[model samples]
Target: MKANGPFKILALLFVTVLAFYLIAYHTIEGRRNRNGPWIVAFTNDLSGAPALRIDHPALAITNVQLVFPDAMLPTNFTAKTILFQRPRPVPFPLPMGECIFMDTTFLPGSVVMRMSGHEVQLIPRVLTINGREQPWKSGETIALTAILTNAISPRLNGR
Candidate 1:
């Protein structure tokens, strides 16, 4: 029985490590599945245009609200200016008439928005409009200004 003592201790230690690994793996996978895909909606309040409402089927959490142009400025404008600045981070919920820049990616798939002066990035798994699904491929960027101009110019011109 003396020889079996060390063997049993070694086996117990190995089993404990295996169990810990399995638990960690499952926990990470669960969190990733629950988090879902990231979505971003950029809206300009000064433009006098309707804000786009973005929704995802798997988006369970409503993230941050980022204000643009101001967020992109390099100088100490926030200190000189008299505007309440929220923490700049990846925005998820589409705040009405307030959001100007929302981004998700860090590099390679960066998109620059002229009005906001900030890069708008997204990892859109599925984008929809009026409850109809729209096709959005990976690394694709949409220009909000171009869409607005194209859509509104004709109406203003009475064409």
Candidate 2:
């Protein structure tokens, strides 16, 4: 019988490619169920408390997201500050369009916030609610004026 070297090589390549694809698919699917800390999503769902009402001055708090460092692996880090866009539309989109901290201490839903592919860090900034810090604990109610953003008068609503 005449040799069929080309056909053999092609078959080998096909098998190799198929095996690699299967391995990769299973590896990703295996990690798909892994649990991660859930950060509170600043979603536009008004069906919940802290519901965002458009036109309300407080609604000035629009998009809420957390920024984290790039050098560190998100699987083992947390966020120190939360960022939000003021005076914007409500009912934002999903995947948040921002990277959330990997730690659940910020949001305790035990859900993973799949992050965006981009990476950036936040500069040190202060948050003062009406000249004082606005510290919040879930389940507790408090109020104050806070200065956010990294620029002068970054305050929304021309504060």
Best by TM-score: 1
5-85 per-residue lDDT for model 2 (tens digits): 888989999999999999998877545423222224332222222211111112133223233222223342332323232
Superposed by TM-score, candidate 2 places the C-alpha of residue 152 at a distance from the truth, in angstroms, of 4.3
- TM of each candidate vs. truth: 0.32, 0.30
Predicted candidate 1 versus true structure: per-residue lDDT over 1-159, tens digit per residue: 999999999999999999999999888766544534344443433533322223333533233223332323333222111111232453322332223343322211222223332233333443432234445543343333322224457769888
Clashing pairs in 2: 44-91, 128-145, 128-146, 129-145, 129-146, 130-145
Clashes of each: 0, 6
Best by lDDT: 1
lDDT of 2: 0.33
Q: Give the TM-score of candidate 2.
A: 0.30
User: What's the CA RMSD for each of the models?
Assistant: 13.8, 15.4
